[model samples]
Target: MGDEIRTILEQYALQNAVKHQDVPRAGAVIGAILGKHAELRSRAKELNAIIGSVLAGVEALTHEEREARLAEIAPDLIASMHEKREKSSDLPPLPDAEGGVVMRFAPNPSGPLHLGHARASILNDYYVRRYGGSYIYRIEDTDPKRVVPEAYEMVREDLEWLGIAISDIVYQSDRLGIYYEYARRIIGIGGAYVCTCEAERFRELKLAKKACPCRDLTVEENLLRWEQMLDGTFIEGEATVRIRTEIDHPDPAIRDFSAMRIVNTTLHPRVDATVYPLMNFSVAIDDHLLGMTHVIRGKDHIANTRRQKYIFDYFGWKPPHYLHYGRMSIEGLVLSTSSMHQGIADGTFTGWDDIRLGTLRAMARRGIRPEAVRAAVIEIGCGGTDISFSWDNLFAKNRELIDKGSDRYFFVQDPVHLTVKDGPEQTAHAPLYPGDEERGYRTITFNGEILIPGKEMEGNDLIRLKDLFNIRVTGENTAVYAGDSLTEIRAAKGPIIQWLPPDQTVPCRILTPEGIISGVCEAGVAGCVGETIQFERFGFVRIDAVADGCVTAYFTHR
Candidate 1:
């Protein structure tokens, strides 16, 4: 029985306990899955029967050594175990730790993962934990023209960074032969036929304005044509295996759509097969074979579902539940797949992780957490007809789910010196962010030494930090010889240039898509990689990467 029955029992018990003003037993089943009070009261009789059954089942297990019996006869026990197996291979030693839910995050490796893909990945991860199921990672690299090697790597890396691990990794390309065989079987059953009509001609035929010359061919003839097409006997695009459907079908996508095609150009990544099977055909067959109970994908493929359903109907197999979501569109930006591919080819965007391209890896590089990305996507939600998405709103939603952690020191640009007077004669410890009591603060040492062109120190005054610091003016202009010139400078009072001791500071060089940038930081702060915080006296900065003697940092300025 569904969990609804258990919920119903719980509700009944709660109501009874509330009315009687008595403590409810912890082990007592009480909860209502349905609505209303009288209706729930009336269902108590049925609930009693369920409880009796549950008790009897438990009683039967009492003799087989409590543990074995409880496991064997408990209601929903088997189903729960299966769910647990999917989420994680290891069954938690503690009963409370075991969760049974199965989820999969399938992404097309056509391009870099964007916010949408991250959302799907997060949802899959969330549900697996919520329901106690296993998470699977499947590559939907069926479209050879769109799939790229870098995209596959990026999808894996981004998810890994998000701490989402899959129990198994499967690819649709590996199942092309099965799809081709199914297509052939459909042809043998007269459920499919081969069409040699060109694009415009096919459209005309689909529109019922023209007749397809190959439409009336017999099953035998169609089978021979299909086999020839698959074996490369037919020229590319000359013959396509089309499912036999009513010509006047309301949905154009379901009308004799291509099941298999002659794609002899390049090798299929997963299959290495010369011939390419249509996505609709391959996905339907693989989903079934892979034991996928649900198919979650972009709503753009909703139309394809009908065609896939027809294939499943011809095969007499139950199709998985489909959850089609709206495409994650970023506002003010035209995310053209063709243009993105072109950009990758032409080096317009550095790599797939170029922040400007809306790639997940790029977002990760920019310090966007995967959970934040997912929360943003879910806030957008699914089931809406096509609508332009607002990226500003997406980020705004992300802020709701992600915690804005304590700030850290971020140096953004060229250094500015500030002189201070009447402040602390010694160094002052500055907090990274006020109110962040846990994070404490980093110390900035003030040695009472101010560098001015030529200046002398007197009493209390303010020393402005060109852009960063304002310290107390301590001394007058002192002559400092640089190379061959002796320049006179004044000591202004403001914030002092609080830098790490020379021994404590380490030289850092940042490599970005633009070029190389150099800076210095204490080794203690090197662990702040992937953090989004500003450096004191510096511009906004993010810890993109950290390596031994080599770190990559992104700067908003040149």
Candidate 2:
């Protein structure tokens, strides 16, 4: 029984790690163990001991090593895992999930949605889809200073491209009256008060753990002040409504926190309203009204969660279940919206869709599919640990999703003319999608001259022209036909290079993260706009445009 249990523990630990790209938690391993071998559930202590020992050994191995081991012992597990990956995700069951949970993704309409935003939105949408419910996309566009006029539409486009089917879209700017009504209710119940203290004085009083003199004002006076605020008598920054909390609370920030404040509504891009609810208050009200069962956000919001809970307690509304994920740092992605915004304003970046940015449009332009983004984040898992994102892992996920579907083409960057001295003028054929003959071949007729990438002729050594004859570099600028046998090249282990007959070439430029690469490709590539194709020996590129005999593309990954 012990040996059998040890095998189960080892297998599941490796399987879990492979699924999540992280070390397996003992809880998951135990669940898998009891799920498969019910008889083992009786021996909890024995199973847990085996799990701890097994996980320690598995955790020591690198991700690659664990994958290799899983493949060796249980290739079936790897096969099914991959097949599962290409389709819908198999996310863990949501805790306390009832009959169809309602979730919401509230993004501030200051910029396009980014990867950091994707985690919360994607995870929320994924759960709603898995459990059968509604996913709300709410635009938290209250701050006139941060709101971008174009960002409202940009956010919609980005989310549409990301494949998140939102059940409804709500803008907070349009719901100001609802917020005002709630603010009035909280005031009427004495849970809040309108204060006219100056900014400096209020900060001083809050620091001293004492309330402003206005805190004890009659509800009639507070209501009159609130009306004056709406009537514009109390201009911007003159008065703010503070939620009544324990004034002497230890944390100064939590002491009688401001819930509503005056804003320059005339300058607001979306709505004209003088009074605006702070994030905690507005979020608490919207979550309750929108029927959000769960709130998935970063761990930085733990303090914000406590602040919002105070509002829920005051109103007797049940707060949504909060799942605060830890911060994630993808090595090469720029997740900071403010930095990207500033860069765009100063002309440091082209736009939100620049390949250099990490916005969803940028990823999409580079041939990173929405499904790939969804899969990568789902595998990263919603843990509280700070994890660094691996470009290799993300690329691997994308490659798996796209490899079989992408057609092959040859791109000769910095074309160096190669002269085949003796080979016959034959029409060489290659399958558009290798291994799938039904798709058929694209024919390239070779007379004598062909174009190869400049790097291919750097050595002036012998090489095969891939699916055609072999050639030996006889000079700095040329290669001569040496032989035409596959076995001959295989014996010498010569490098196989991609070549395009000059007559069949079209001018091409690839937008890459490093820089733009100028090249020429087979004429068939001109029609690949809106499609991602593999440039044999190079990487996959998504064709963006074709204008005046020039093809424009963006490099995806190797």
Residues 250-270, model 2: lDDT tens digits: 788888888999987448876
Which candidate has the top score in TM-score?
2
lDDT against the true structure, each candidate: 0.58, 0.84
Worst window of 10 by summed lDDT in candidate 1: 480-489
For model 1, how does the per-residue alpha-carbon lDDT over 1-558 read when each residue is reduced to its tens digit?
A: 446765445344433333222324434543433344455565666666666444332222111123333234453542443242322323112222243544578778877666656667775565566556567797878777777777778778777877786888887777777777887899988888888888788988788834477878898999888788766788777888888788888877678888788776766665666567777887777777776665666787778888889889988998876677666556532255567788878988766666556666666665556665655555555554565666555444443333236264533222223333333344545566544557777665544333331221233344332212344342342212111111111211122223433344445555443455566654555776776554443433456767775455654221
Per-model TM-score versus the true fold: 0.63, 0.81
Off by over 4 Å in 2: 1-92, 208-210, 248-250, 487-493
